[model samples]
Target: MPDHLSPDPLHILHEVFGYDQFRGPQQAIIEHVTAGGDALVLMPTGGGKSLCYQIPAIARQRAGYGVSIVVSPLIALMHDQVGALHEAGVEAAFLNSTLSFDEAADVERRLARGQITMLYAAPERLTTPRFLSLLDGLLSRGQLALFAIDEAHCVSQWGHDFRPEYRGLTVLHERYPGVPRIALTATADALTRTDIVERLQLEEAGRFVSSFDRPNIRYAIVEKKDVTTQLLRFIEAEHAGDAGVVYCQSRKRVEELAATLAGAGINALPYHAGLDAKLRQQHQDRFLREEGIVMVATIAFGMGIDKPDVRFVAHVDMPKNIEGYYQETGRAGRDGEPADAWMAYGLQDVVNQARMIDESPAGDEFKQVMRGKLDALLALAEATDCRRVRLLGYFGEHAVPCGNCDNCLHPPELWDGTETARKLLSTIYWIKKQNGIGFGAGHIMDIVRGKKTDKVAQYRHDTLSTFGLCAESSEAQLRGVLRQLIATGALHVDAAAFNTLQLTDGSRAVLKGEVPVRLRASVSAPAARKPRAGRREAKAASPAAATLDAAGLGRFAALKAWRAEVAREHNLPAYVIFHDATLAAIAERAPQSLDDLQGVSGLGVKKLEAYGADVVRVCRGPHG
Candidate 1:
């Protein structure tokens, strides 16, 4: 390790990033990586995963350890991070396909001269022969600092966003055995973590796994009914004038929903693989730079978005698994402010997911694993207990009822669903026995509810003994019950039969009265409604803004406006200049001088020297 790496990381953190202390295991991870040791960091999104490598990079460079090379998956992510580093007075650059040949050559020259502190490269570019030759040159000159592989979960084939190119990254360790390597990921399960370690050749790397809880995010899953109307109502009631992301599963849906939201007067944009590359980039830039802009997109939108003030993330369609759901929802409340994760899912989501799995070209084992994962998410959606507790439990963490989620805020009453389960299962069995195949939920529901539809009459199902057996229950109530049954493994969907309802072995127990079923009583539409907090209540609820009084709120808003102007001037994201948390601290403290401003968090020595006077003037206002 270089002597500069021996400096107190706290000193570097306070001077560079303006943070007084490290969060969670950041300090330890930084120390380990800076000491020329390998590490695997598993942290939730917005958990400061960047700093785990950034601080060490700066420390190593300051000590003359050479340039830190960051292998990222997205060019936009590189731009955002490097821009922030520049505003903090750190010398950073990125080389990717986006750069012109001349621009790329300039960056290369800088790297050769050791003029840059860090270099961010796309994994594809980093694995190229030219880049590898450049790295060899840097290594020969003893100017290579360390390697940071971000989005390490992409290395895992089992992960949601798997990239085959990441597998080629092992050349770093093979070619340069002395250079330390650190792999970081925002989302990863045990299996994915293991795969990351193996694939990245970090089998002996120190593993730092942080808690996967985002307490500031309130989770609510509603049954899909008139989805467009429900989505509009959610936006109007809970997230008016706030920046957010609405995730859809398909590109067409993304476009249609974006139009719908825009027609309704929400500043919305569509983003997906189908859009022109430049258009997608422009939309992403606007969302990062402006407030109250909602981006309606498929899963393509939010892999590396660094926006911190997104107040909500609404899912118009269900994700295929819990990991994807967790990673997507984790995008909200990144600044540790209170945010919402609202999703609307129904039986169709289940059918669609099953159909997708069945139609996929992946092997049977992979398909089975995917089906199991989807079932876990279904269980979470239909859970009657605290959503936070159940969600955490899926990741092997046990948590208490959060009191912030829909279930905890309004606990559902349990009803004896044994009779109901038996009735539904018997109806399915009867249909299969009589017609030689099972029917879809709708047809089965009509049979049980005694609806004489054309299909039901064509099959002569209206004359069966099971007809009208569930007339006391509404269609919605029966659907909810069936969904819960599927979640619990007593029922399943036969994808080969067009998602026909089928009974599992467990269903036999329920039908024989050997098992008792208790389920959340079905409520009407808007079952997952949460009480909307007014402005005062919202500010009071936000821990970051809680300390600010009326005057302080005004000051905070003024500071934000000034920051926005400075960001525009520098062609950087607003948060790059100063995060909302840092601004809140400054507004609450009301620092009137450089000396006083120095005490605030997030005002490092470089930033303090660069913008300290302006910040003090803004805080003091004209009266001072």
Candidate 2:
């Protein structure tokens, strides 16, 4: 029945989940929740937030609270989490639409009789009257243990992934007053945090805000030239044959890039809401089960995924806010291995995101808030100091310069682009004034650079005093300057007029020399990226670089093969069976017996009992 055989949380931790000690605030959070205290935990993506709730579910169940109800947002997440819990020998089940009528009935019957230890359901289902009635029955019987809200930021309007359905979750606190509830999230700013607490009525809950820094994931944002070719080089040169995810802005881009990557001999797949539901599921399944599969997707695919081996997350376009970027990039390196968060950004990306916000039929206040968020992201991208510092600082946390980001590796030289920026803006103003209409960025750039192209000749713009005043500036450098000008509100994109440039009141400052415009000297050169980091990182060149001896490598490879077979037989992702780090440790030591495997980090009693002998057999080579 997956019952907890001990009263101690540490004992349960070792025996059930197989970890030696708690990390950061895990021990305190677990103890608080098990003793019937509510908590709001804000941890990074790979920071062991699951253990905070999962361990309490086990401990409270053992202490006679009966069953824990977990509120999850996605079915895929619930399925994978329940599958992993079952592997750890915890009695967990999820009741969603995936179950047939009889299957749901059976699960309900079991729940009514208190046969399940933990139950997972979406917020919509959890708040439904039918489900509440069942919960009432359990409440009357004193069977309800705890209520865990995962991704609690969805309750906030200011959050990146807000959902109106989450506002209905206040019912959990109102209905189950005494039941200890834990709200958990991976990304939440101070504003979103307050919203979550107020909306979920967790004001009295203990707040555990861990450091938001992810040291294992290096950050990089390159100026875009050929985005696909740049992405191809990134994947091939450093992360070839590694599992990655490339995020695009549109469904068509996702489809096209997936095909392009496949043609380049990379195993890639397309996943977006536009595809058929069945096909989307198939693509997601392939991405989960297979190694070295890159998923080209939009924001639709990456909320509650639990895959721990993703090597990189690339963005071909920029998102509207820092919160969204942080959430999407957090998907990589959940195993605490070295990974990357790479993006190809440019002036057009800024324009697209700004245009999206400007054209939306939203309130003025809402648009203002969105622009504020977008400006923060632009600052991070254009940062000359440290990307990590800029990112961590946005969430109201302070961090020193991380020597792992692109800026730290290759310091950018900022040039006084005031003369250049003024020239470009003046050219745009003159042309629009003469023609009583606006032109796109291309015409403006050509005129400022003295291109003497047919259009420039047709407009006779070469005769203007501002034309070719900054002919020495490269197009790339000018684009960087222009992007900064727009980002700083000195320029505006006339989305209603085919995305032509227009001057705002703020532009007058730059033109009158009241503001200075500085930009990176060489913006679009992707060849300048060099690898470096300040922290000691796991060698990501292979599965187990620490075990590079021929025998250890062979043993690790064989263990992985065995794990793949077991995962296929069980119909789960290979990491769900065991993490790569766990298997690598086992291979490095070449455990001689079952007792030798007892203290490995992820090897719980249940896992040892289930797969201990087979792991030993695989370690002893073919004839063992």
Candidate 3:
């Protein structure tokens, strides 16, 4: 057996995972779970959540416990995780619908003979009678180690990616009374966390809540203007020749955007539910195994992606809620490298989202909850304060200015818009009085800008006192102000009225001058052409790349080349071989031998034996 197979969590961490120390609550969670204690872990994505359960499972196995059964929702995630574990010289297998009956039987045989240390299965499969019978046999022989429920937030109906099958997971606890259970989720609010505990029947589990902050990712939200142009500019400026995910609101938009990127010479592919299963799998596989491929997709593309080096996640349209946005953006910078969460939103996004909620067949209570969530996201986008602070605050946490997001980098000046807000509110009220109906932003903006269009003339609203009150402001500026007002609760979009703008009860305060409305100043438009300074400009512009020097960059490039070659040989993602963080550490340290290489983080005994010499040679270079 390998040294990591020792009956010690610390040994497993060092020898199998090649880390010198645990991060955040990893050690405590691991120790608790290994001691037969149930745990509910709410760590952010890329925060080492996997180690909390993986280390414990390995330790339990070494302590004469049976194979750890991990319940996962995604077959791709299981496959990627199992591949990484095998590279670390650990025995792991997955049982999912993707496996043929004979292949699944072989895995079952291995589990029965104590050949596998960890087994991953989809929740639907785990709850089946045949699988339950297998588990019963294992339990009868005392071969069950523990149970781990991943993506535990799926148990909550209110969560972004609720899966009904997750509710049936309590069967594990009921069937195997003594087996410890640990539920893990990358994105969960307080409500979702409670739901996980209740649904998984892990009320007694220890709660390990980490901060929901991804400081490595820079958050940026820009007003949508020529969306394709903006998106192309962002890609060309910062993320050219890098792996990323671009999220769109609809399948048609995803397809269109993917084609646009491809026409611009970007290696982009579209993914959605509309695609054939084989095509989707092939695209996902290429994204994983190849470098610098961008996946243009809707929300369906990112739930189970384990790729860690994605440099950016761009949203061509707004998400319905903050949780969905956070989860999608969390897919980037998983390796602790600098990544970007860039979004382009406009007033239309809000109207479209409101329309979606109102048109849904869900109950009134669910609609209200969803509306509240969408409003919170809108507030975040329109916030003049720190974006990180506002975002974390929504999740019941507090944070100071991160200084990496757009808000912090270029602090928006607060312009008192009390008069502007009053004018807009009076217009909405007056329009209702005249026609007993609300008007969307376009007509309202036209009246405000004194455009005197056909609708304005037909309504004869040119006679209204509030019409053209703010002719000094441009259409874009007025739209920005209105978005902020809506976000601040001074105005609301009446979903039932075709998303017409309406004044809320709180609008009285602003109209009466009792409240001061401070809105973010409009950002100046960019120059027609941006300067081209090559990769150096890209690296220097990113906060995440501040750590690299010229020599380090050379070594990093060499290490990446080696990783790519190895990944090709194994038909695995480059990150699955070794994350960029590990490569950067190797480049910085320039390890000369196997002993020195062991000191680098993420280089376990298995990795050191397999690639230590090649890594050292790459570090030394030809001159050395």
Question: Best by TM-score, which number?
Answer: 2
lDDT of 2 by residue, 1-624 (tens): 344577478988999888889999999999999999999999999999999999998888888888999999999999999999999999899999999999999999999988898999999998899999999999999999999999999999889999889999999889889999999999998888999999999989999999999998889898899999989988987788889999999999999999999999999999999999999999999999988889999999999888888889999999879999999999998878778999989989998998898898989988888899999999988888889989999998899988878888778878898988888889888988898889888888888888899999998888988888778878888888889998899999888998999999999999998899877776455345554432223433344345456688788889989999999998899989998778888888898799889798889999999999999999999788
Give the distance in Å from residue 405's predicted Cα in candidate 3 to where it truly belongs. 1.8
Looking at model 2, residue 554 earns an lDDT score of 80
Report the lDDT tens digits of candidate 1 across residue range 213-243: 9988999888888899999998988787788
- Would you list the clashing residue pairs of candidate 2? none
**Could you tell which candidate, 2 or 3, scores higher by TM-score?**
2
lDDT of 3 by residue, 144-237 (tens): 9989988888889889999999888889888898999999888887777777878888888899999999988888888887889989998998
The reply for model 2, stretches above 4 Å from the true place, is: 1-4, 432-436, 452-463, 526-545
The lowest-lDDT stretch of 10 consecutive residues in candidate 1 is 534-543
User: In order, what is each prediction's RMSD in angstroms?
Assistant: 2.5, 2.4, 3.2
Model with the higher lDDT, candidate 1 or 2: 2
Clashes of 3: 0
What TM-score against the true fold does each predicted structure earn?
A: 0.95, 0.95, 0.92
Query: What TM-score does candidate 1 get on C-alpha atoms?
Result: 0.95
